[model samples]
Target chain A: MADTEKKKVIKPIKNFSMEEYISSGHRACQGCAEVLAVRHVLKAIGPDMIMAMATGCMEIISSPYPLTSWNIPWIHVAFENAAAVASGVESGLKALRRKGRIPNKDVTIVAMGGDGGTTDIGFQALSGMIERGHKVIYVCVDNEAYMNTGIQRSSSTPIGATTTTSPTGKLEPEGKSTWKKDMVAIAAAHGIPYTATACPTFFTDLQKKIQKAKEVNGPSYIHILSVCPTGWRVPPNKAIEYGQLAVDTGVFPLYEVENGAWKLNRKPKELKPVSDYFKGQGRYRHLDERFTQQIQDKVTERWNKLVELCSEKPEK
Target chain B: MTKPMEQISWQEIEAGGVITEPGNASCYHTGTWRSQKPKYDENACIRCWRCYVMCPDAVISPDLEKNIFVWNYDYCKGCGICAYECPAKAIVMEED
Candidate 1:
């Protein structure tokens, strides 16, 4: 134990906690973006939190029998009610804390659900939570379908996309014909303190947005584009790739709305073609040359609007 | 181009932060457990630990004698209550 004998510098890295909250065993389909995003969000939120999960892929996979992948306090009440359960948890805790019967403000209640839960069935409850100004965070892990319910179509399911309910065939050129509902804008219009969209593949950006949401006083909503390899009919390893494609192809814009201002995160220095993003997946298989071009045009229009919004922000 | 999951360093999936001579970073891999990192602004911190106490993982530590709350992220779930609860806007979240 002598000095100067080449003290191997174990280069100091970013110090994170040693405690493992989301324990190892869970059966999320490989390349499941929801799982990846949830893990990052939990890590960012820290352990002193209770989460209300909706009836989705997350709940079924994490909680089966006595075996639970979640190391922290987590709950799965029902489908389309993740926000409701979270709102109940926040208000219930407030009452208990005020009575000095339980831990005072020691817990942060959060709701995590899929696009189907937050945008369709649970939309009313979600709106109520935001409008009421509950001190909670709601994260919509939008895989774009009801994965737990066997890949059914949800309101947020993109146009010309395929789902179990909307499978393409000779009769149908594409699957779903409806456009994706704008849930983030819906959240923003509720006048919540914070609203933003994140992709699971970009963990750093997702983490930063979560931090921003935490600082808001009333309620915060994070709409995450969590890719679904099983639903998307792509290879297990391609989950994050889909997320990247979504942002790069302008299908999903990476932006944050703070105090009614939009801030775009990444701008493609050399934008990739939308078809490069679409052709990789099986869902878009039935779309003909004509339809694909139309879809691309729509995406471009939306992206331009986003850029305008970003530019509208009045300086620092 | 496709290698076994075991062969690939989980760190490549995510290294919280790293130092490498060859421009390689230590991935704070989410391959194993979900991670959360805390950022602090000491200048604005009143040392009031709404975050330290609210952290479900209890990863943050403060020398009560000194009143400075430091984040220990290994156990942190990245829930962001510390950043949210902090009245002074002190605690921030760093992606791992």
Candidate 2:
């Protein structure tokens, strides 16, 4: 008789509290993936944390005057200074701890912002924060465009997508002409201890990455591909599906660069066509077949480069 | 639209970075925003709890006594994510 094969069982996290840190009554959109990402990230970090939120959709929705949804201590700073503020907080707390001003110094420091703030306006501050080796986690909730500012194109916006600023017309048929900025590569180039990409669709993967970022001793960068139903021109219900498709189609692959070592988190069994991800979005609805093919070629090239990076040995 | 500093009285001017009463957002009911509602079928539910886990609103809660999941509609914005992600097809979105 053949030996009985033992199946491996994957159990969920034990004693995971479903407590809500970001409570209801806040004015986020019905299908706002950015706020959802914040909720999940806060849950992973728990109560003993302070957030330095940049001026963006997350800040605007949560911190309207006299009303707030955040259960943790949160500070709202300028659009381009969340990282700078977080660095100050980290240093200030360290100083206070040394002077016996605070009893404990175990609290985590987090800085959050939208794609525009992260990849564009806040780039300099973020670079300084990482280079200074502050114990902080900088989370870029990349919804691909400036969703808070009425859907303007940002550096992170992908090519061939239509935004208010990058409108598709007779003159500019391809919409946004520039490719999406490689933010993960930028963070990795900073030589941070941990840098990762996550999406809300993969909850466990996202949570694990957040937890890992929290555990890192130095600066960590987490780029989350938050889905924007309103900006992306997809139905509210399709947010998760679109997020999943982004991963499956290699438009946004989930990976991490830890201590200069690259690792691919989720390799799709069979890569889906880029059209499968783009067809649902209204932003990409204006794309012709030729433009879509061009976008597909770009995605394939980027994915190939990523795969090569993952397979290569890290330098000493 | 900018108001002159001299024209604005101290009493009328709003203070910045101060929340006297924190976490009072719960006092406000946002259920009026919901256009559709989630209907759960207890019989069809296989206790997978995918809807409970994936709800972005955190409105779904497991009823240990009843051995089922319940939706707190007071804050649910009717995103349909719960129904869309239900593995057992136990949750359905219906017009409210």
DockQ of each candidate, alpha-carbon based: 0.02, 0.30
Q: What are the per-residue Cα lDDT tens digits for candidate 2 across B1-96?
A: 223224445575357756545455665566779999989988677666567656777778877666667888888999998888877787889999
Question: What are the per-residue Cα lDDT tens digits for candidate 1 across A102-203?
Answer: 966567678988887788888898888888888889999998888887789999999999888998877776789878999888888887778999986676
Location of the lowest summed lDDT over 10 successive residues in candidate 1 chain A: A4-13
Tell me the lDDT of model 2 at A289: 94
Q: Candidate 2, clashing residue pairs?
A: none
Cα-based lDDT for every prediction: 0.73, 0.86
| Two-chain DockQ for model 1 | 0.02
Whose DockQ is greatest here?
2
Model 2 error, position A54 (Å): 0.5
> Which has the greatest TM-score?
2
Per-residue C-alpha lDDT of model 1 across residues B1-96, encoded as one tens digit per residue? 123234556555434222112101111222335444557886577654445433433456665444456655433445455675577887766676
TM-score of each: 0.73, 0.93
TM-score, chain A, candidate 2: 0.95
Query: Model 1 segments beyond 4 Å from truth?
Result: A1-18, A314-316, B1-96
Tell me the tens digit of each residue's lDDT in model 2 across A44-128: 8888999999999998888666667778888999999999999999999999999998997599999999999899999999999
